[model samples]
Target: MADNQFSLLSKRRFAPFFATQALGAFNDNVFRNALVILIAFGVAGLSSQQINTWSNVAAGLFILPFFLFSANAGQWAEKFEKSRSIRYIKLLEIAIMCAAAIGFYFKSLPVLVGVLFLMGTQSALFGPIKYSILPQQLKPEELVGGNGLVSGGTFLMILLGTLLGGALMAHPGLGTTWVSVAVLVIAVSGYLASRHIPLAPASNPDLKLNWNPFTETVRILGFLRGNRAVLNSVLGVSWFWFFGSMFLAQLPNYTREYLGGGAQVAPLVLALFSIGIGLGSMLCEKLSGRRVEIGLVPLGAIGLTVFGLDLYFARPEAATVTGLTAMEFLRAPGSLRIVADLLLIGLFGGFYIVPLLSLIQTRAPRDRLSRIIAANNILNAVFMVTAAVLALVLFAAGLTIPQVLLVTAILNALVATYIFSLVPEFLMRFISWLLVSALYRIRVQGTDRVPDEGPAVVVCNHVSYMDALIVMGCVKRPVRFVMYHRIFKIPVMSWIFRTARCIPIAPAKEDPELMERAFAEIEAALANGELIGLFPEGALTRDGEIAAFRSGIERIIAARPVPVVPMALRGMWESMWSRRGSGVGRMRLPRRFRARVELVADEPMSPSEVTAATLEARVRGLRGDAA
Candidate 1:
């Protein structure tokens, strides 16, 4: 709609927030990498074991604040205007950077460690404010793109920071001085950028700030249970973090032990992975047609598992050669497969996370969006900790790095399967999307004529058995279809139909009771302000032409009195599922793959104006000889 996701970068509303967040990420990574470098090489008078111990301690110190302060941070974000809070948070970062500068200059390990803890605290507080403000600042249609750009920029900055920090810290005397100066400058720049961010009003101004983390954590998680979809999506996102953490945490060892690479190679591999994720995230806006399509989540999960397993198998047979650098590894036989696996794994991760983040913002109650994001942060920390523990357990059990990767991949499949089973809408949407995308290239027109929210009846001229699936894929929102009972019972599609809660009707003469119940359910759904879709023609066209509109449309409107939106599907009677012959005796297989099909919606008619004949004429005019 706005050219592409990158167009958002030129706009005033999103640009400042983008720069501020990216700078924050860059500063976080630079400081962390600087600390890691100091422990590994710069710091003196410490044994290798002691260095490892301190490195682990620093990691814990950083993550611990997320566990302790996320709940309170969530409350703070909701209780205050977000831009104002972010400005103050950035100011806090400047002060922390000053402390870090002093710590770096003095080469005092204790000062640096304390400064790292404060940096982590700053991040924990900023997490909720960042996500909750997007819904307030952008339109619903812009959310996915905004999130994509944010995610891509954040990862890109992280890669840059890691590279720059490692390079700067390795220098002789100017290393510490330069690192301190860079961090301080970045911190000041971040604060300046925050100044331009527009004010996002508080989501829950009256919410009491809960000081106790333990009790507040439980209460927030409890509140999250109010929406299973939101909660499950949050879990799904956390699992990705768990999966990603395993790869990132073990990458150095993996590069050394498995690929026989040096310190430089691990960072190169990380860069490749980061680039892949950024590309995949930017592509989501295009793949999803600028909507929050949860269908992509299952697709992403499948890719995550598949690519992860391939990565395990992709490990090249340990060559007799040693000291292979990243460039040499790339030149080696079979190494490209490993690189491809990592890149695709990161790409799938982008697809998996962006929509889920958008879902969290949109599906969670507007009044408590920040708290829910906080709950997500807490759970993400928990999941990441569990992943570390799991990796350790696997290593203790005598598994190789590749074997550990294989196990995580297998576990990912099991977990994803279990999650999808619990929430079949994701799977159903994926299936419908797959079916339509595989069979035809659909062009939807007048999609905006359908209300974005609220109860409405959509009547389309049904041309094929795949009508509902096509509609489901095109419509951004989920719709409950009122379909034929026989069609609903189709072998493989039955499961999807049942999961979608499609209401199936039979002819009154054949099954009066079923017809009555179906009508009752449709009315109840309408009463609940849910979208209900039906074909007023009642059955698929037998001759690639619109059949006479049935009186059932009149009955539906008379009972529910909701707006009736007339739509028409053209170029579908020739599809595989259509009955193009004189009778069922001449049913044929799919005639074309990737055929062009169009769905056109007319302006919604008021209840009093939606006569069967009038709706039929409107649809016919919209179809306009495209049959």
Candidate 2:
């Protein structure tokens, strides 16, 4: 029923925030572009070098506020309702635009530059509220789609603003007057949209306001150190900004120097790249089945490296080209490949960034979510600025734009490998998700019964060697499986299991020490508020029938007394991984492609009320005729 991510636009909860943020982005670009154009062309009696200096100063001024006041913005968001805060920010936008209009009328660079700093401050104040409000508004399953739309909308608006603002500023009849009017109008529209946003209560109503940006910024980043996933996601996102800034900063130079194209060619390249990003962001929802699938991160990294390398090679020698329009450049030999490479890089960029943003929104502590986002903004600004500096260093070192592209591409590969290695969970989940989606069509029922957070024991009927893999893939939350030690050590699957932190256990008769260790580990995990999954059947079924439940579950639950959830796996016994014919001999057999598998879960049983026999019956009933 929910086929398209755009469907969210019709809903009140999402649409208003979406409109408000999109318009804010549009206005930001419009004002910035108009000011840059006035400096470049309309300014009276200024040297080319002085104009360039002023432009650079303006650029640095815009980014400086994100570093200076984001911590205070985050604190304000945490201390008050987000919707109210957004309205206030939008009001500030109107005031800024009013000031900008006056600056544009006077054609004063200082006035416009000051307005730019205020614009940056406005954006910084809204940053945390914009992101932190999403998780509170959308369902978990809808997060990817919501984020995709937001990303697409933001970039699309940027492209539009760039085109429109430049057009309006250079227009014979309109000039500064029209651009100023547009900004003020858009600012008012943004405020009107913000009025419709649903009320979102402060996450930490009692959070103390820390107005000192320096100390608070340090404290905010310190909060991230405790959350490895959130911290890593932040780093990943920052790297993306770095990569993007480097690529974008080189586009004009690349078009002019390498492609022998004019000013128009830069915009053409930008349209291609930004449009590619928009489409790719929307495509993420479809590829991920509307879930926040971090698997796309690795996939994006791969594309970035591959297309980036191709882009370097696609660079034709400067001698082979002459000054050409964008259309002519495209019609030229080797240009289409270059364009394709740019598009794919943008596509992969969408794949890379949308998930990381959603991951931070979903995984960060709710109370500190805004502050964490502030930290992310600060890091992103730092990385982007560093990327600009690195480009300067590279140019000084005599590296051409294409050579720099090659280096960035290689660096992307190294960084991706390092990050994924550090957190094998990302890769392991990707592998498990890939295998499950490729080999079986999973239909999960009663997913809501699984606790969204906190500790619980998931007891399921074990039907085949692939059972844990299937469960791991389908479950929304990360889980630790208790598997037989031999199965835990089985080939490539063993590596996946180890990376996933599955507990390996042996029966008391075989190894008492191992058995004791397993229980101890399970208890520790539960105490730490993690999910522990176990196959109460102890081993895979031999005759497509439910095996008698093992009493180990009782001991495990009795020690911890957490809720026990009963789950069932059906239509798996006939799969090649099952011992349907030759028992262990069937281990090497191949499964039918895309087997239809159903994983059904039932209500969680109170720990005090659950027993081996009762839990077994519950799982059997859930499995029914399929077992």
Candidate 3:
């Protein structure tokens, strides 16, 4: 497996699909923006009212297919091979663009609008196939990185398409002609690229087709409710669209009226926002250590709110000057602050969304993943429409654009809080991630040795009080650590332990009943196919040396008869949380911050081979001299 996500871009499995999707996005925006420009500029020679009406109608036409056809689209994606379905979808795009060409050649507003609707239908069909195919093609460890690339590429293409489309339509005579040709060529190019995508077999080959959009939409939504975490993650995704659309819808007006900028400044504002998202999306793999770290979601939500609120105060009043170009706006007083706020909002938005998509992909039932994504598409459309309606209502009540943005930012905080409350795992993971990352520069190895899905026992050396947090942060999956009951009760750490579902165990001598309960719980967790993390040393090392393993691990394995994975934590003895010193002086401030640490894992041993002494040796060897 490639350690870096960008490495996937050079491989056949990902590169072709990336090209096809990026080109398709570019074409869609090129056509849409061109049509909008044509109408707004009276190239269609219509009355002002007609132009306004048609512009609104064009936006509605594009979004309508996601609402009307997403149900059937989801079923088709599941029932057919994904690569072939992509080809067919691209072929449909070619047909739509051909029609759009004719519409543009004759300057027919109605025909162009109809072609836009067909384009939406093509996109709606592609939506489910686009995401559901990732897990099929990539390894579990690569999912987050893959998603980051896709997300970043998408926004980048949208920016490029928007710019190109507007540029083509701005031409003197042959602007429409240029757009029509560009769309056709891009459509054909996307189809050709789709041909290179590796075959992805149908997820539900025998799935009964559902042609009824209304009933299937309702039925598929029920799939979401089957998993609460998955459902909320889906909601989180839709809420992002709502938040994004709200900001995007107001950006043009905000740039013009408040920032005192001309037409050029709107795209610059968009570029800053889009670039931020792209950069943030790419950073997720590194920040998350290449796991689907939903911890970043909370961090993202906080940034979105903080920067969004700051945007209003950065320039609460309208610009004192008007018609400044992009560069001029940059030099204006307080303009850089506004620009920074927008950029950071987009950056944090990237941080917020990528992991949620990865979570839905990994957690949603494989056979039904397409339908779940389709349901997500439906909800996204609804939320985007609601955002538009809400904006209008706010404007009707005479709220300025800045005030509306402030309200949206505040609403973002409330919505994020509610969602996080519903699934505290996101918040809990965030806390662990924040604390661990702040204190240590961790290097992880042999994580792939841990089974992606199964029941197993993981035994590691206990070097510090912060060991569990470090292990939890590095491991791709959730771990229920068996910790000393006293450490589990340690003030701030206690809340984290409880929230993470860590099992608190007392020594059999001190509390036999609690020890027995902990053993029983560990057994139950294993039976449910969950990973149980145990520090067989049973206590933090007082002298920075490996201690004798306890018999409790042997007892658990003898009862459960499952595989045991041996792991080690190195260079943690000198950390502030470890019991390395002779006195209470050890509790004082550390001599260093962000100390280097490593978590290493060895292959799993069968239950019969996993004695206390043997597992201890394996862990010690993995730790080596780094301790």
lDDT tens string, model 3, 284-321? Answer: 99998777889999999999999999998898888888
Q: Model 1, range 1-627, lDDT digits (tens) per residue? A: 566778888877899999999999999999999989988888789998999898988888998999999999999999999999999999999999999999998888889999999998999999999899998888666889999999988888999999989888988888999999999999999999999998898888998887999999999999878788898999998998999898888888888878877776888889978987887788888877666778889999999899999988788344456678878988978888888998998898899899999988877888888999999999999999999999989999988888888888889999999999999989887787677777887777776578866899988999888998877766656789999999999998998889988999998998999999999999999998889998988888878888899898788889999998888898887766777764646555447667789888889999999898999899999998998
What's the lDDT for all of these models?
0.88, 0.89, 0.90
Question: Which prediction has more favorable TM-score, 1 or 2?
Answer: 2
Over the full model, what C-alpha lDDT does candidate 3 score relative to the true structure? 0.90
Clashing pairs for predicted structure model 1, backbone only: none
Q: Worst lDDT window (10 residues) for model 3? A: 583-592
On residues 125-244, what C-alpha lDDT tens digit does candidate 2 reach at each position? 999998999999987767889999999889889888998899898898569999999999999999999999999999999998877899999999999999898899999999999998
Candidate 2 lDDT score at position 40? 88
Off by over 4 Å in 1: 316-320, 444-456, 527-529, 542-549, 557-592, 598-627
